[model samples]
Target: MASKGKISIIGSGLIGRNWAMLFASVGYNISLFDIDESRIDDALVDIKQQLNSLESKNLLRGSLNAEQQFSLIDKCISMEECLRNSIYCQECVFEKLELKVQVFQQIDKYVDDKTVLASSTSCLLPSSFSANLNHKSQVIVAHPVNPAYYIPLVELVPAPWTDEKVVARTRELMTEIGQKSVTLKKEIEGFLVNRVQYSILNECYRLIAGDYVSVEDIDSVMCDGLGLRYAFMGPWETAHLNANGMKEYFEKYSKGIYDVSKTFGEIPKMEGATADHIANELTSRIPLEKLNERRKWREERLIAITQLKKTLDKH
Candidate 1:
């Protein structure tokens, strides 16, 4: 496919490689840059293999074929070259606050006013890193799920000083590339997804700690019970569909829900015997050696569900 414009992806790790492929599949020229030379080389190889695999399975995204998408990615030797003339750049570096600050400092120096400086951060607030940058107005957070190719939801967040136009442009770019994007009204720690995720984890931990449920049962509670309904609709929509509507549903279940929530009590520390027991159970089922295989298995299921949802929506 012909290029639309240039996008630079810093730190060519897993997230970076997925971002590169997603952008390239939609005809964007991608500069995949990493400070470590070998890492960049390895990313390129993995990206090629992934794209080719997707193509062979007829699951490749956008209008571009595997070879075309692979051709669009350029490995950069220097930050200067990667930042030059790019319309947007996503920093996919390590999640440490100090490391992000330093990387953004470097990116801020290189990028021009027109370029959008977005971070792929999961937990850190944008104000923490972009506050000291010269181009703070252009800085925003566009956090994607681990595998950007299948999981399309991206949380778009802007620092207080970030330009409104930058946020809009980031959303536009994400949509154009076929990713679902939502913008947070204001900044907060852990963003949207992680906050929801951690809430679930906390409860799960509490249950296990209290001896009310096993780790595997908690997993089944999600995968077999809640996960089935949540796959297509959110809790609110599911409530709407399950009952008459919001008002009637809330009237019927609010008291029961509130009562159950009150029973949750204090949060567990998630340490000591409970943590060790949970770890052992998980590791026994998914050993360290097969973790990667399990992760890949999970990603394949995500892709399948994504495809299923798309097909159903069309009908």
Candidate 2:
């Protein structure tokens, strides 16, 4: 399904490199550009290693070998070259606002009017960077998480001035390239996923600081209990299924939920003993020395999970 147009990735950092692999593995021609050529140089090596890693895990598509898979990436010396025949460009540079503004300005000049310019920013909104560009209507945020080669959720956030058709096209392109995209009806801070995550994190922190639960118990509560159900069903879906349906579920639990919510207060500022406790607890489990190795393990596990999901979908 990835027989779409070329994908040009700007910035050769972790996000850009992963985007290159994701677009390439699914059969899109990938072009990468960076001011620091060494970053691109290093990225090619990392991508090759990643491809081999996926192949070792039996996760690569189209029965392609590592060498054949690596052939889809083209490292362009300049932005113009990368944008020459591209239909979409994903900018994954630093998260700074001014840097994104400058990068988008240059990319706007090179790509045609129809080409979509998507930002990989985690926080900065599209309107923050793309507002000054001539092709602002064609620009939007296509934020993907780290290790995008494995995790495919992309948030497609559009600015107020962004064209609706452009958003539709971006969503279509993401789908064709094997990405799962969720559209935001209107722009909001942090979009959907992070806001939900932060809200949970805030509650967890409050509970721990209030001495209601131990740090280890808090982590285990999700990993052992909630995470299992969350893996297959969302919160609302689980709630509905727990009862007869959505209406019945709400009818029985609305007052209980209201009372529980009333007891919950705003999260405390995490700057003192609470933060230190979390740091000590997490570090004891995952030491700073093994951080890089642990990250690789997490990526490998995500790859396996993604492969399992693909197999399940086939059935």
Candidate 3:
């Protein structure tokens, strides 16, 4: 197959590897780079294993098979080599402000005017790192959820100076790669996903701190109850469907919701005895040694869900 284009993936971590796979699935020639050269080789090995495993499960994406997709990625020793002639550069470095800014500055020096510079940050705002770059207009955040291959939502956040055309093009590219995307109108501290996540987390922490619910039970509330509906539709859609529509739903439940909201209390600090207790409870169930095993278990389910969604959409 002819290549779609070149895509540069900076950092050889899980996110960067996943991004490479996502792009390579669509036949994009991927340049994978890392500051530590050894990690690049390790990433390639891991990527091969993952692609082959996905193929065995009949979960591999796009028209290409595992071998073909794997062949599309090339390891690059230097940032300049990775960004050379690439249409998009995705930075997947660690989430420190200074580190992200430094990486962006380095990338800015190598990137051309046309390449879309995207960061894989979950919480950091785009402007915080891109403000001083010459190619700030090209910088945007394309934050993907964990296990990005299965969870297709990619948040597209643009800095204040980001070009309108850049956002449009990035959205188009995301669509081409079979990922769902939501664009932010303006920059926010945590962006959409993390903000909503932290809100839920705050309540969960508060409940545990107040001895209202056990950690395991709180998780069950999500996995067994809310997650069932959330897998198919969002909260707004759930409310809309539960009642006649959104208007009727709000009208009937508004007072009760308000009463509950009033009692939610202030955000609890995610530390101290409560944090330790939660950790101990969770570790007892899954254990630190089995975390990777559990992660694999999670990914398998995500893949199954992705396939199920595709099959359902067909009907």
Cα RMSD for candidates in order = 1.3, 2.0, 1.2
Judging by lDDT against the true structure, name the best candidate. 3
Backbone clash numbers for all candidates listed: 0, 0, 0
After the best TM-score superposition of candidate 1, give how far the Cα of residue 313 lies from its true spot, in angstroms: 1.4
Q: Per-residue alpha-carbon lDDT of model 3 for 35-144, expressed as tens digits?
A: 99899999999999999998998888999999999999999998998999999999999989999999999999998999999999998999999999999999999999
lDDT of 3 at 237: 99
Which run of 10 residues does model 1 get worst, by summed lDDT?
263-272
TM-score of each: 0.96, 0.94, 0.97
Order of the predicted models by TM-score, top scorer first: 3, 1, 2
lDDT of 2 by residue, 1-315 (tens): 355568899999989988887777667788989988888999998889878877887777555577776888888888899998788899999989899999999998998888888999888888888888899999989988677777788999999889998899999987866888999987898988889888889989999888899889998999899988887778999998999999999999999999998887986798899999999999999999999999989887887787787789899
lDDT per prediction? 0.92, 0.86, 0.94
Question: Candidate 1 lDDT, tens digit per residue, 203-266?
Answer: 9998888899888999999999999999888889999988999899999999999999998878
Q: Once superposed on the true structure, which residue ranges of model 3 sit more than 4 Å away at CA?
A: none
RMSD of 2: 2.0
The model with the greater lDDT, 1 or 2, is: 1
